[model samples]
Target: MKVAIEGCCHNKLEEIYKALEHIESVENIKIDLLLICGDFQAIRNTEDFKSLSVPAKYRTLGSFYKYYTGELKAPYPTLFIGGNHEVISYLWELYHGGWVCENIYFLGYAGVVNFGGLRIGGMSGIYNHWNYNVGHFETLPYNESTVRSAYHTRKYDVYKLAQIRQPLDIFLSHDWPTGITNFGNVNKLLKTKPFFGPDIATGKLGSIACDELLFKLKPKYWFSAHLHVKFSAVVYHDERTTSYSESKEMSSTSVENPDEINIDFDEELNNPDEINIDLKDGVNQEEKNKESNNEKTLQDYIIEDDKKEQIPCTKFLALDKCLPDRDFLQIIDFPEANGKFEFSYDEEWLAITKATQEYLTLSSNAKPLPPDNEIQKKIEEELRWVQENISQIEAGLVIPNNFQPTAPAYGQQQTFILQQPFKNPQTEDFTKLLKIQNKINPEGQSPIRQD
Candidate 1:
């Protein structure tokens, strides 16, 4: 089945609409599903950073629902998963007792959905970075209280997935698993002071818990979008066996001669698959090997061929042509360039004529419009009704002229006062505890660490 996956749209409604429209125009294509990885809004909260209890703001899911319901004339279904910035949108839904849209499915927290006989499991939540701060003197537990709270709230999602013993076909999440690309760098940009504070010593990006689960589950495909960068990897596991045998030749022969009732037994044994540990220059050699193997799959071959065929030009071509200064003029050039032609001009008349010619060429072999049958008549009637009631449909939905708010706008300059590290006994005691914890868990647990 074909699907279109996108993320981090960031409330660019026109762009989203254009993307959907383009996808829809692909002839004979059967797009069974649309998956959004999250970050559908430009901002998480209002200008004041205060959560909107109402759903008036375009950032809210309600706004998205209304827009999509009206504009997106898709032939298939769409799914939405939450990202970090979608917290406010989710909050609005929670206040209203969850989203009410029937067509749009919200995979809140984590859930499983079946699409065209394929099972897709989605887990949405940021990494738990609070637990690691317990021992750090630079960032205390109290300072990381927000992180702790968010982690606690999402703890159930972690536990719920642990109970899932069956493997999934596709695993979708907002953040990439640990050790995947430069996710660490992206997470660091989002971390501000006074809330878990920034620790430049360690660059962490992904969730250790999520990584553990991914390793154990071993899904066929995994999708994530938090890093805003494309990354992929294949994990592998290995199985091995060993055998040994010993015999006493002379003694056994003599015993067999005395009593030919010697008995022998053999049994097969199986062991759990053991993954090879490959440590090589900060790269996971085992994963690299698996990815190499994965690249040889049938789908990879198909995708490669599709990519080759989808190129707009069959061959490189460079051509220049000059038109006569007459109203009606024809210029001729070799037609073997194998390039799609597009026209641009410095004058309005030339541009219009070029566009018209291109349009006529495209439509030359197009199917003619159907006759005014019953269905067409009905459609026309509906169109007329829509046109008549357009104003009513637009009631209370008009875009305000001066909607800008005079509040704490985004990107406002702010100053922070960093105090010297406390030298109290409590701080020293915590520092000691942190040293031990750091030894046990050397890797920092956060979305930024994934890099």
Candidate 2:
């Protein structure tokens, strides 16, 4: 599979698609998919500006509205996650992953999907310690605080991702993992962004939740943006193993297990009752006893499962923002990928979502997650239910083209916010498939057409 990975896309859709087309013309290779890491800025109409987190002066509509309104069609299959900057009202309508347009799909606040035989997973939004444990409390006509906090990474989303035991081919995040600097060329990074020295020295950069997921998931390739720099690093899973990175500028770094690391952890993670305390491999009574006795840390509980098969290392890459002469895009060839693949709902992810939808909260405060055993049992049950109920349908696991434009499109010259959010048919259909409540909106609309 010939896949293109783009860094922060600050609403430069035309430039990005044109660049990919230029590459295709020169190389004579077909690009199968495009994965964008955050800062997507899917602004539709002028009213969406009211919900955007950006300052009023910097709020300008980008090219996505054209695609939304069917004026322009995406040249390739595109998938993206949200970042700190987004149209919160629109995104909130499809919080559990849905087609943003004809060929473009949003991975929701956090989601996993199957495309071209690859199990692609991602978590949207940047991390903020203050809002990490909160619920989805943001609403339309967003106030200053809700607008910003709405995009902040939440524990419920991260916890759902952490439960996956299967291997992930590629993972995406808007922020780099905490302590990731220790595995890369910190000296060169400091030379370029000298102001980052203090944060690097104190091991205070990047997201702690992301760091935990990196160790827990241990995906084959992890890509990110938000730092606005092109940096690459490889994280070895074993105790002490050194390997050179594909990037020649620097060598990879090996480190100890997640259990032994003593980096700063939030107060909530330290409490066993609130957070899930099982290893990625699953939980045992012995480990639970160790956790209670202070013999193991919360990071240890989230570490890789020794019994399950493990990937040697996770190759981490963070690209720069989309601009002239910036390292914003990367093309990767998966020669081993075979057969034509269509976009579909991943069985494991569907099961996870079905099992954990009740846990999705709307409160402003933190909540407790299910124990490891309970989570495992629930996932297994839902997996079977999905196979019986959804996989048997004629459409099967394929994501149907049920897109419906509920908001005003660009060029409409409308400046006022709608009294209520239009119930996107895609969201309604997706939730209907899983038999879950539509938490984002209550109304419904019919599909206009399918591509």
Highest-scoring model, TM-score: 2
Worst 10 residues of 2 by lDDT: 269-278
lDDT of 2 by residue, 103-145 (tens): 9999999999988888899999988877887888777668889
Collision count of model 1: 10
lDDT of 1 by residue, 1-451 (tens): 5555554443433444344444446343334555666544423213312222113343333234333233333333555565554434222222101121324455545555444445556665455444322221112122333322321214334433544445566666665554442212223223421221122113244455555556555565555565433333333322210100011111100000111111111122122111121111222233235446754887876775575354321110011000111111011122222322211111211121111211111111322222325333434444344345432353311211111111112223233111221122221222242122211112222111101
What is the lDDT for 372 in model 2?
72
State the C-alpha lDDT per candidate.
Answer: 0.34, 0.76
TM-score of 2: 0.82
